[model samples]
Target: MIIQMEGISKSFSGNQVLKEVAFSLEKGEIHALMGENGAGKSTMMKILTGIYARDSGTVEVKGKQVVYKGPKDAERDGIAVIHQELNILPELTVAENLYLGNEQTVGKTAWLKTKEMNRKTEETLRDLGLHVKATERAGNLSVGKQQMIEIAKALMTNADVIIMDEPTAALTDREIQTLFKTIRGLQEKGVSFIYISHRMEEIFSLCDRITVLRDGQYVGVKNIPETSFDEIVSMMVGRQLGGRFPELTNEPGDVKLEVKGLTRMGEFKDISFAVKSGEILGISGLMGAGRSEVVETLFGYRKAESGQILINGKEVQISSPIEAIRNGLGLITEDRKTKGLITDFSIRENISLANLKSISTNGWIAKKKESALFENLIKRLRVVCSSPEQQAKSLSGGNQQKVVIAKWLGTSPSILILDEPTRGVDVGAKKEIYTIMKELAEQGVAIIMVSSELPEVIGMSSRVMVMFEGQMKTILDRNELSEEHIMHYATGGDKHVG
Candidate 1:
């Protein structure tokens, strides 16, 4: 085995986050770590990489026990981690970001080999089918491109053992295939990978073995060919989740929000749609198809060159997010870490940030009202946190996403827009989110969900609107929803709308 851990245990402030977990990775094997958020998957990997010291455990590398004081030490031993949260420095160039601390130096002198590094960066990216200029500013690229940069950064390490956390969360289908190909190539060279993702399709297709964790404890390990999806899910969530998506009983009423020829200069053009009360209008499209840009324009995050936004049959002006909220529209942005919540704020503060009017009186905040709101929403969403005072950044990715949803829920908006609502969420939490979405729709909230996952769009949408290259191709009804049909329209199969 290339790596092994026995009886791993860890805790924070007396709260046990991991307990007696065990894992092993064979050389050149693609091992999958499966668990719900806060189930100790990331924690286990952190301990393995010396990001967090285990309270009690034995970690062996190539049959020898080792203790790494920091991630750099672990890197020296051929273990590199690409964390779920990206580590890219946005302000730097692609080449600069790739070689940040590991730059090529001229012997013992401080002179750098810039030309060689850029050329190497270009070659590495090209190998992964990423066609970005090494001199381009990393911040200007799309999230999908940025994620590819992360993968490229990890590959540049030339580590024998690599751990990827949700590596394809932002990647396109083409990019994912390229990544898999790259991974297989590395495996052929005797490199091993510890793959972490909530995507079951990837696990089934790419991984060799699986290790399941539940509630911070080890479940069991199984070979890829020997285990079934149902069994693996049952083990991870500790219960049978009846259906991947809950039944939507909501019937559409009068239109709550409408856009007429919404045109944004270089992004999207002449976008038109209407979402009725108690209905979900799912926006489906490929990367750079302007799905997000359309929504951003509607939410006033981007300016529309020309368009008319009609909220409840009357044209309304939305020049900013504040105005959007004032008009009873709430947007759960795509990038939750940057746009959705303030990581430095506590749960109580973040939740109250959007609904101060309901919890305040005459310019003074009501503590009891705020606390009640926090408690009620936290319990409702099943957010895993020690207390309301816990920093938003401290929660797991899934929990942080739930908190973002809760913050918007507090606004009690008539129209709610969720952009990639469950991107990195596990199966169990996804069901809960679907339930909440259903409940809100039943209560007459119009939901606009933009998703790249076809299953989610097909399962939740009342109507799916496929966009191709900034134009609406077609909108299919629930009875007409299918992955094949959606993909056809998404790729400009038919140019007719409605």
Candidate 2:
């Protein structure tokens, strides 16, 4: 075994998070760690990477029991972990980030070797089958490119073991294929990898072995070729999933939104669509195809050069989100952490922010009414919390998205736009959200869903709209929504009218 963790135990405040967890890995093999949220997967990885001191455990690397104090110690021992939460300096270039630790020499800092670093970074990117410039600012890159950079950082370290948590959560299917190829290449070169994910398809595709952890305990480990998706999911949830999705039978109502000639130069042009009550319309496109920009303009966050928006067949000017909301429009932004919710505010405060006018009397917030609203939404959305006073930042990604949806629900908008509604969420949470969305639509709300996941867009959208190079391609009905057809439209290979 290249690595072995035996009898690992950890806890906080007398609550055990990991109990007697055991795991092992070998060279040239991809080991998968499967678990639910707060099931101690992150905790186990933290202990392995020296982020936390294990309560009682023995870690043997290549048959040698070692002691580590911190991340630097782990790094020196050839262990690297790419955390789920991105940790990149926004202002730093890719080359700078790659060589950040090696910036200074033993004696003094020399004239910062820019050319050598650039050359090495370029070489690394090509090696990983990615085409990112080294001098470009890390913050300017898309989430997929940023993820490639993180992987490059690990490769540059020449670490023996690379631990990745939800690596494909941000990448496209093609990018994920490239990543898997790179992982195989590295594995052949004797670098072992530990992959963690809730997606069983990805696991069966990439991993050699699977380890199931539930409720801080090891359920079992199985070979990929021998295990089935049903087996894995049952082990994780401790039962068979009743149904992947809930029954949604909502009748169509009158059109609540109409957009015509929506154009944003260099982003999207001449985009026209209408969403009716009790309908979920999905918008899909390749990265940089302007799906987000179109939605942003429709929501009044970006200016549309030549467009006419009408709510209920009446022309209206929507210069800002406030105006849009007043005209019965609500938007759940793509980047939830930045644009969806206020991370610093309490759950109640965030949930009630959109309808503050309704909850205020004479410019004074009605505290009691606000409390009732908070409690109501929390219950309605099934937000996992002990009280409404919990900070929004304290919840998980899925719960945060629920809070954002609840916030928009407060205003009672007739049309709701959810951009990447299930982005960065677990499968269980994704199903939960889909149920909520279906329920909302069944209640006569118009929904516009923008998603990059092909399966998700096809599964949830009653109709799918494809965009390529800032132009809307053919709008497809649910029956015509196949992965190949969607990809063709998304890649501008299909006939279209701008």
Best by lDDT: 1
Q: Number of the top candidate by TM-score?
A: 1
What does the lDDT come to for candidate 1? Answer: 0.91
Per-residue lDDT of 278-388 in model 1, one digit per residue for the tens?
A: 999999988788988989888999889998999999999998999999999999887888888899999888999999999998989999998888888999999999888
Give stretches of model 1 more than 4 Å off.
106-108, 496-498
Error of 2 at 65 (Å): 2.9
Per-residue CA lDDT of model 2 for 71-148, tens digit only, reads 888888788887665677869998888787866344465677677788889998887667778899998876667777
TM-score per model over all chains? 0.96, 0.91
Residue 402 lDDT in candidate 1: 96
Candidate 2, TM-score vs. the true structure? 0.91
lDDT of all predictions? 0.91, 0.82
